[model samples]
Each structure stands twice: as C-alpha cells, then as structure tokens.
Target: AQSVTQLDSHVSVSEGTPVLLRCNYSSSYSPSLFWYVQHPNKGLQLLLKYTSAATLVKGINGFEAEFKKSETSFHLTKPSAHMSDAAEYFCVVSDGSTDKLIFGTGTRLQVFP
Candidate 1:
C-alpha cells in the first residue's frame, strides 16, 4: 500500500521568511505525489505534483517540491511566506493499484506578522 507522512503537525513562519513543510512517502512502485493546500473555509488547492517527468516541480503561489526517489521524499518549500499562506497543507500519494489518493495527516502553517 502507498502512504504519505507529514513530518510536521504544525509549522509557524514569519510573513517574509522561508517556509518548509516536510513530507515522506512509501510506495511499491513509481508514485505520483502532490501537495495541496486548504485555507479557512476553502477547498483543497493543488500546489504542485510529481509524475515521473521532472524531479523538481513548481507550482502556484511561489511553492515548489522536489521529488527525491532515493530518499522517498517530496518536501514542499517556498522562498518566503505571505500572510495569506497560512493554511493547512497535505501530502498525497497515488495508489498504483486503484489510483486512489493517500493523504497525510496534514500540517497547519501559521504565518505571523
């Protein structure tokens, strides 16, 4: 079974500081990974994705993730965080057999002024 684990349950950053949300995944075969963010009362928005094409994948809102097959990690990072960046982030992996998504517990990002 494929699974994803979010290393941090909570991450706090300043409005202009760098943000790092760690994630690790386990799969029997090549996996499709994704990062999704959800703001208060908002739906899950796709941040970035990796599907065997490129190792480094960039997404919207200055967010990006590098797929490291050797380490089995797909950590999300941003050069700087904004006040609007405060939200919940999820690390998801696709199950090869059923094409179902396996989501992480989630990491809450709090951006302080």
Candidate 2:
C-alpha cells in the first residue's frame, strides 16, 4: 500500500526563521514524491518532486525536501519563513500506477511577525 502521513497538522513559525514540516510515506514500489503549497482559495502549486532520480529535491519559494528511503521520510525545510509562506501544504505520493496523486490531509503553516 502507498500512503502519506504529515507529522503536524499545523506549524507556527516566526518571520525569517527556518521552517520545517515533517512527512512520512509508505509504498510498495519505488514511488514519486511531491510537495505542494496552496494559498487561500487558490489551486495547488508544485513545490518539488522526487521521481527516484534525486534524493535532495529543491522547489519554489526557497523550499526543499530530502527523500530518505531508509527513514521513510521526506521532510520539507526552508531557511527563511515569510508571511506569504503562511498557507496549507500537502505531502503527496504517486502509487507508480498512474497520474493519480494521493494527498495528505494538510498542514497549515502560520507565520507570525
């Protein structure tokens, strides 16, 4: 089976501080991993993706994630957190079957000044 679990449902961070959102996944075969960010009332934008090519993947908005097969984790991180970074993020996984993507419930990022 393939699934994704976001460790935190909500994360609070100060402006300009580093941000970290944890995620874990399980898959039967080599899987494709993705991070997506969604602003209020807006569609999801692809932050980054891991397709069995690279372990360290970089995305938009100064975000990045490392795919660790042994740990079964793909945690996202950023050096500086911005007010605009305050939004919902979803860790996604592809079952290696089709284009269908399974999304985690979501993690709300709250940025405080």
Candidate 3:
C-alpha cells in the first residue's frame, strides 16, 4: 500500500516571503513521489518528481523538494512567494504495483500582497 499525508491544509504567506509545504508517505515498495500544483479553476500541473535517482529535485517557479527516505518525507519549498503562486498543492506517491497515484490531502497556499 502507498499513502501520502500533507502536513498542512492551508499555508498563508506574504508575496515576498518563503514558502514551505510538508509531506510524508509510506509505501510497500520504492515509491516515486511527486508534487503537483493546481491553480484556481485550472488542472493539475506537475511540479516536481523524485525517483530513485535524485534526492533533491527542482521544479518550476523556483519550487524544489528534497526526498528523504530515512524520514519518509518530501517537503516542497520555494525561496520566495508570488501572487501567482497561490494554488492548491498535492503530494503524491506511486509504487507501480497498481500504477496509480495515491494523493494526499491537498494543501492550499494563499499568497498575500
């Protein structure tokens, strides 16, 4: 079984401040983790992914995440926040057994001016 947990249901940040979104997971096999962003009234967009190759992965719009196997965590971060960054983020895991993504409870990011 593969499962994911996003630590925050909502995160509020100033436009110029930093952003952090925490996530944890458990999987029976080596899992492929992903971070996806959904803008208001928009479809999900792939932000980043962590396979077996790299522990640190960078995504668009200055977003990045570090995959920690020891902690079973993949936390998303950004150096600074933008008004356009306001969106719903999801943490996902896939082990290939079912070829389906196990999505975590989404974390909505609210960016303030």
Candidate 4:
C-alpha cells in the first residue's frame, strides 16, 4: 500500500496570506516523500523532500513540510503567499518500487491581487 492523496484540488489565496496544502500517504515500508512545483509550461521543480532524516523539512521558496509517521501525512506550508507562487503542486511518494516517482493528482494554487 504505497500511494498519496492531495486533499485540495485548488487553493486560492490573497497576495500576502499564508498557504497550506494537505497531503496524506500510506506506505508499507519507511518511505521518502517529496513536494514539487510546476509552473505553466515549465517542468516540475523540487520544493522539498523528507527521507527519514528529519520530521520537519524546509524547502525552497519558504516552503516546508512535516513528516508525521503516525498520521501518515506530509503537508506543505508557506509563510506567505505571492502572486509568483501560483503553480501546480504535487505530493510524491517513492520506495524504490520503480524508477519513477508516484505523484498525487496535484493541487493548483491561485493567487489574487
């Protein structure tokens, strides 16, 4: 049982508010999780990752996620929202089952002026 589910399909925020994206996952073994962002017409870029090293991990663009093993969750958050931060985000899970990363449906963030 290795999979991920992004709770929000879309999130809208005003230009200076906080941002939160929820994700839940299940894994048979110890797993590694990742968050990635993709801008329009651009490839996906790594935001942050957690690999059994730390429960709280920080990524680029003021993004961070906490790996809660008991709850099987890895939710991403940002201190403040920016118009440029509008993009699609994906929660990923991988346990060496394949060379590819298992991606969630994705959550699209919309920032308004």
Q: State the lDDT of candidate 3 residue by residue for 50-90, as single tens digits.
A: 98888999999999999999999999999999999999999
lDDT (tens digit, per residue) of candidate 2 on 19-74: 99999998988999999999999999999999998899999989999999999999
User: Top model by TM-score, which number?
Assistant: 3
Scored against the true structure, residue 109 in model 2 reaches a CA lDDT of: 100
After aligning candidate 3 to the native by TM-score, how far in Å is the CA of 99 from where it should be?
Answer: 1.9
Per-residue lDDT, model 4, residue 112, is 98
Local lDDT at 89 for model 2 = 97
lDDT of each: 0.94, 0.95, 0.96, 0.95
Candidate 4: pairs in clash: none
lDDT, candidate 1, 1-113, per-residue tens? 78899999999999999999999999998899999999999999999999999899999999999999889999999999999999999999985568489999999999999
Model 2 worst lDDT window (10 residues): 95-104
lDDT of 3 at 9: 100
TM-score list, all predictions:
0.97, 0.97, 0.97, 0.96
Candidate 4 lDDT tens digits, 1-113 = 68999999999999999999999998887889999999999999999999999899999989999999989999999989999999999999998666868899999999999
Name the weakest run of 10 consecutive residues (lDDT summed) in model 3: 93-102
Task: Output the TM-score of candidate 3.
Answer: 0.97
Clashes of 3: 0
Which stretches of model 4 miss by more than 4 angstroms? none
Greater TM-score among 3 and 4 belongs to 3
- As a whole number from 0 to 100, the lDDT of residue 61 in candidate 2 is 86
